[model samples]
Target: MLTRLKDSTPKTLLLGGAALFSVFPLLSMLSAALQPQGSSPAGFSIPTNPQWHNFVDAWDVANITTLMKSSIILVVGVVPVAVLIASMAAYAIAQLRIPFGKVFFLLLLLGLTLPYEIVVVPLYYEMQSLGLLNTRLGLILPLIGLNMPFAVFWMRTHFMSVPAELSESSAIDGAGPWQAFRRIQLPLAIPAIASLAVLMFLSTWNQFLLAIVLIDDPNKRTMAGALQGFVGAHSTDVVLLNAGALLIMAPTILVFLAFQRYFIQAMLAGAVKG
Candidate 1:
């Protein structure tokens, strides 16, 4: 016991220090939010009189309700469709070994390396050509396509990890491919699906560049994009900026807390295994 404790002492201290280091920025932001709106304090100093209403004022001034609604709409539009399509594609490639499966999967892997900047111009032209610019469907469809490479890759890895016997058993019971995927595979892959949903939600919620470029209206952008709009308008108000940031961040944090166990499982099971 003594030897173990001694060995663990440095590791514990290291982890504690890292935790404090990671937390300092959050503490500083929270502290800044409590200060008077117009004042910009340099570091980690607490205010003598905390201006708690800054949050309330920030919400009203920023029209955060509208911004949140826009974000929610995008999340609902993108996440389910992306997850469903990706899950089905992964199921086909991983289990059924669709013809040219390796080539298709390789193309998606190549997409992982394609930067947004490289395709933004062409994407703009395509959206414009399809008369989709500035519309929610415009943003929704592109996000689903952009997310597919990673989502399909992640789900495919998870599906490949599942045992082949499940399919064989279903076959013995006279289940078709669609039936096997819907009944047996979907239930067995809940953890992977939940983890993918969390990731898609986070990415879609925080999407900024596409929002600014694709959607013209400030009212129609994601929360993070709306925050950028908020910043441009309220650059001089430090406290309001921080308050709005925290408000925008709350949903993603709640989602992560809810499905964190599944997220850890997904990571361990090679969600990003290229």
Candidate 2:
């Protein structure tokens, strides 16, 4: 027991150190946010009197209420449709063995290789011609398309991990592929779908370059895009900037914390099956 404890001590210390390293920045940011709006906060400085109202003030200054609404709209518009399309496509590739499956999947893999910046110029031209530029729909469609490669890839992995016997059993019970998908596979895949949805939400929420380029209306921009303007306007006010940054980040953090259990389960499910 002593020998085992000694052996584990190094690993425990390493993990503890890594966790502190990861959390230190967040702690510093929180400390900064608690300081007075115009005050410059040092990393180790605790406020003499914590100003919780900085978050409230920052929200107004950053137009965070509208920014949050816009972000929520974008997330909702993109995540469900993207996850659905990816799931259906993944089902086809992983379960149905669709014709030329290898070729089709390879094309998606090619998308993963191509950076968004490389594609954004041509994409802008296309949206401009369609008169879709500067609209939420413009962001939605492209985001769904952009997210497909990863969403499909992730779902396909989960579907691959699912047992073939479930489909066979459904077929024996007189269910068609579509029926089986609705009644059997989708429910079983809830964890995976939820996981994909969370990832898509994070991606869409933080999508800055695309939102800035494709959408011109500041009011219609995602939270990250608005943050650019917010930061520029408040460049000199470090405390307020940190407070606003935390406000922008809060939703994703809350969402992940809320669904972290399912997220962890989904992550482990694939590995357990494999």
TM-score of each: 0.94, 0.95
- Score residue 114 of candidate 1 by CA lDDT: 91
Write candidate 1's Cα lDDT for 1-274 as tens digits.
9999999999999999998998798788889999987898789988899999998988887888998999999999999999999999999999999999989999999999998778788889999999999998999999999999999999998999888999999999999999999999999789899999999999999998888899899899888875777788899988999998888888998999999999787777664544
Name every residue pair that clashes in candidate 1. none
Model 2 vs. true fold: TM: 0.95
Predicted structure with the largest TM-score when compared to the true one = 2
On lDDT, the leading prediction is 1
Question: What is the lDDT, from 0 to 100, of the residue 246 in candidate 2?
Answer: 86
Q: Which stretches of candidate 2 lie over 4 Å from their true place?
A: 1-8
Q: Candidate 2 on 45-98: residue-level lDDT in tens?
A: 778899999888888888888888999899989999999999999999998888
* Candidate 2 local lDDT, residue 226: 59
Model 2 whole-model lDDT (C-alpha atoms):
0.89
